[model samples]
Structure formats: structure tokens, C-alpha cells
Target: MIKPIIRLLLIAALLAPGSAFADTEYARVQFCWAMGKFDHTIYFGEVENREDRQASFDDLLEISGIDHHAVKCNTSDSTSHRLARAKLLKDWRDSEFEIVNTTFLSDLDY
Candidate 1:
């Protein structure tokens, strides 16, 4: 089990947007890919299935002005996922962006 202080420090570290990856186009793709692939019921509510989840992610990419087809999620880079996940977590915690909430993803016509 993680100690309280350690957990708090971890949270604090994630909350800090110190990495440039948070704003990169590659990170955007990684973020969208993760949103599509993961179970985000706590935030965006439930998706109908895997297809719907992917469709939602596609819609998100479209809405964000990104080309879904052109994106090549660099799965080899662990740092990229960490940075993207951190950015997502930070946005969720602070409610800093529209993309991080249920309303934004749910409202998309998937």
C-alpha cells in the first residue's frame, strides 16, 4: 500500500503541468487514443461497446481538428502515455478544459 504522503506527492506531481508533451500534437493523439480505449465511466459515463468507444474517440479527434487516420499512436514511448495521462488527470482534477468532462465527450454524435 502507498503511504499517504507518497500518494499525495504523486498526485501533486501529476497535477503539475511541467512537461512540454502536454501541449504537443502527439500527446493529443495519445490522449484521444487512451480516451477511446479505456473505461472512463466515472467521468464520461458508459459507452455502448468497444466500437462506440472508438467512434467517440474519432469524433473527438475530428472535433479537435485532428485527422484520426493520420495519427500513429507511438505505443513504444512510455513517457508519451505518462505525459498524456497526466495531462488528462490534471484537467479532470482542475476542470480546466472542456475536453476532460462528460458533457464534452457525451455530446458528440458517435
Candidate 2:
């Protein structure tokens, strides 16, 4: 009984610090867009919490072949919203892909 308890405590001690550190080191990225006819916007983003798992924005651009400098929109609406968008943009900018223009085509049922 005593040996099992000691082993459990040791394991917990070794893993506790790593779990806490991981929680702090992870970062989140999101992609959001609005489509006509839908009540809410569509969003897709990645959360990169690990150093090795984080994808460079430049790589994303190269793969997609997009220019990042052409994006021109006021993404700053609120503090929380701004921060979330910034994180996504940072990843995109790092990959060298810029948003040019976003147009939404309406699909209303007549």
C-alpha cells in the first residue's frame, strides 16, 4: 500500500508542472467569415498550443499562394473580438498570405 501511494504521488508531481506549462504556452487561431442567408457567421481557426505544432503564417501563405499586404478591413470592433482576430491574422501574416477582399453573395430564396 505504501509503495503504491508513493508511486502515484511521484507520478503526479512529475506530470503536474508540464500540464500547467502547457496550458499557458498554447495559442489559439481562428478564421471567421459571414455568409448570406445564415443567421451566424462561419468561423474556423486552429489552436496551436505547442511550439512544434504552431504553423507559421508564411507557410500557410506559400501553400495557399496568398498575399497578406492586400488585406484592408477594420477588424477592431471590441477588445475580445479584436484580440481573437489578431491571433489569426498573426498566423496568416507569418505565412505571407494577406486578405484582399471579402465579398458575400446573397442566396435569398425568392
Candidate 3:
């Protein structure tokens, strides 16, 4: 009975569109790989929900910390892409904490 219920839940998740990505916002920004440099200027105006994009951008800023805490990006381009990881939690317990996956993109290939 438990197996059947678990299977049904998995099926439901797969059938739901936008369910996983509903609150998962994306942004296009200039980025460099971990240990790399940030001298490029990529655009980030193609994301959806322009009215609410700023909030997402702010979230990204906190995740990357701009010139502070940042993780390795997921893209090979390095000049134009998306952040590989993010941590939205303002406060988390030491034992309950986990590293947010990091990813990014750029355009100039620099």
C-alpha cells in the first residue's frame, strides 16, 4: 500500500506543469566561473515577470553576494548564463544547513 501511494505521488508530480518551476524564478546575468574574473557585461532583460524581476535579482545578489560569497557556475560559456546554486534561507540551523548549488552564464567568453 505504501509503495502504491508513493508511485501515485510521483506520477502526480510529473503530470503537473509549472508546479516545480512556479516559484523558481530565473535570471540572465553576466557571470564568471569560480576562481575566474568578472569583466564582461551581459544583458538580463529577457526574463519573465519584469514587474517582479527585481525581487529575483535581489535574491540572486544575496546568493552570489556580488563581490563576496559565490560558488562555481554551471555553464561553460562563463560570459552569459544562470547561477548554478542559490540559498534563499535567511536563517537555518547548523545541522539543517546545506550548500546551495551554484551556476551562472556570461557572453564575452572572458
Candidate 4:
């Protein structure tokens, strides 16, 4: 039980957009590849511009090649087979983008 939890945390931390992996073209590709290969991953991004946020979400899905729709969900769920809305968790100036609620996975996905 503890092992699974620790592994999940480690995976999340590794995939997270940390200072070590700045958002660059190569970084985006690497992130997308890692995300596609991982069965479980949750990504959150903060951008001030709404248009940029939307574009980022599109890129995230496109680069990762995950086919999905916006559903309603929360962070407390232990299962990934749930519905959740993809919206900003906080204010618009600092938006939160989640791409973990995907319904369809491309060939590249795990």
C-alpha cells in the first residue's frame, strides 16, 4: 500500500513541470512522451492568458495525442475512471489546466 503511494508520488513529481525541466520545445516533447508512456499522470499548468491556456491545453493533448473531453472530477478520487470538468481551479490570472481526464488514448499512450 505504502509502496504504491510512494511510487505514484515519485512518478507525478518526475512528470511535473519542475525548474529542472523548463518549458521548451524539447522539454514539451519529452514531457509528452513521458506522459504517453505513463498509465497514471496528472498535469497542471498556470498561465495568465486565457487564450494561451487554451492553446497550451490543445498542445498538451495534441502532443501527447490523448483524445478526451471535458468531464467533472476532483483530486480526491482514487480511481481514474471518473468524470470531471477541465477548468481553472483558481483565478483566471493564474489558471490550472488538467489533462488527466482523458477518455481516449492514442497509440503512443500507455
Candidate 5:
């Protein structure tokens, strides 16, 4: 019983940090998607609500404490292309967190 408890504690210790790191990575990917959207909006001369987008990005950066320079946005692609890529990234990011959460919860027998 003591050995089983030790093993469980070790497993929890190992998985705890990984979950936090995965959350940070998810936030980083979200920031990257916002960056892509910002670039795409500006690339097409859509300045009507540009300030709003900028504010949203700024808010996210401030809240997440993530460096804006960490992720570079691709400006070579057309706005539509960028939007499509952003959609794919969003889907991947969402699915990844879902899997991580499910696995983590299952591993803990929760």
C-alpha cells in the first residue's frame, strides 16, 4: 500500500507541471492566432475596427504575459488564406487541450 501511494504521488508530481505547461502552450497558440488575425486585417486595408483588434491583442498579451515577439505572423498569405490557417490552428489547439484534460483527469482517476 505504501509503494502504491508513492507511485501515485510520483505520477501526480510528473503530470502536474505538464498540464500547466500545456495550458501555457495553448495560450501561446491563441496569441499566435490573434497575431495572424491582426496581420490579415491590416493587410487588406480593413482599418474600420483595426483599433478594436489591436486592443484585443493587447489585452490578451497583458493577461497572458506572453511576449508578442515570441510568435511571428505570416504576412505573405492572402487574408482568406490566413483566416483558414487560423481556423485550423484554433481547431488543433482546442482539440489538444481537450485531450490533455481528459487524459489528465483519467490518469488521476477523477
Candidate 6:
């Protein structure tokens, strides 16, 4: 019984941080494309908000410096893209307009 209790305590301690991390909110985003009959998808992970998302994309463009005419936004809004889009709009600010992805990073990092 003592051994079992100790193991449980250790497991709880190990999982505590991850559980707290999950409780923290974030924006999850993804990108998809099609080629004839084939399709491809890429996951961009979670981002903070619209400005942060734009900034991240801009940073990506700056580093990789690719010429992409448009940036698609998603959250938990549109039926097709629900949860992520909604989170973006819920945290919407006038200064920022769109979100690129969501992050599991802590609020401070965001």
C-alpha cells in the first residue's frame, strides 16, 4: 500500500505541470493544399493571437523570406474550422486582425 501511494504521488507530480499547461489557452492552426487528386496538410501548431500570428508569419517570411500573397486565418469560428477560429476571435484585439496557429507555450511566452 505504501509503495502504491508513493508511485501515485510521483505520477501526480510528474503530470501536474502538463495538466496546468493544457489548461492554458492557445490557438491551434493548420495549412492544407491540393495537387490534382492528392492533398497535403501541414500543422503550424498554436499561436497567441492575431498580431502574434501575423508577427510569427512575418518572422517566418523574414527568416525563410518566401513570397506568399495571402495569409489564411483560422480559429474556432467557421463551421469548417471551429475551435481554433473561435479562440482567435474571443481574444480579438483591434491592434491585431488574424491568427496563424495555436501554441501550448505558457501565457508568458505568448
Which RMSD values do the candidates have, in order?
Answer: 12.9, 19.0, 14.6, 15.3, 18.6, 17.6
Point to the candidate with the largest TM-score: 6
- lDDT (tens digit, per residue) of candidate 6 on 40-71: 22113333333335445434543543444334
- Which candidate number would show the highest lDDT if scored against the true structure? 1
Candidate 1 TM-score versus the reference: 0.25
lDDT of 5 by residue, 1-110 (tens): 33532542343343233222322222211112222222221111111111123344344444544333222222122333334445534443543222111111111211
Residue-level lDDT tens digits of model 1 in 1-110: 65533543464455344324443334222223323223222123223212234456555655755432322222212355565456545544553222334434643564
How does model 5 fare in lDDT? 0.28
Off by over 4 Å in 5: 1-31, 34-59, 63-69, 79-87, 90-94, 98-110
Worst 10 residues of 1 by lDDT: 68-77
Note the clash tally of each candidate.
Answer: 0, 10, 16, 6, 0, 17
- Residue pair clashes in candidate 1: none
Return the TM-score for each candidate structure.
0.25, 0.24, 0.20, 0.24, 0.23, 0.27
- Encode model 3's per-residue lDDT on 53-93: one tens digit a residue: 33343345445445422322221121222222121112211
Model 6 scores a C-alpha lDDT of: 0.32
Predicted structure 5: clash tally: 0
Q: Ten-residue segment with the worst summed lDDT in candidate 3? A: 84-93
lDDT of 2 by residue, 48-68 (tens): 221321133223433444433
lDDT of each residue in 1-110, candidate 4, tens digit only: 33533543454453343323232332111111123333333443332211223344545565766544431112212111111112121221132223343323321212
- lDDT of candidate model 2 versus the reference: 0.30
| Reference-based lDDT, residue 7, model 4 | 46
lDDT on C-alpha atoms for all candidate structures: 0.39, 0.30, 0.28, 0.31, 0.28, 0.32
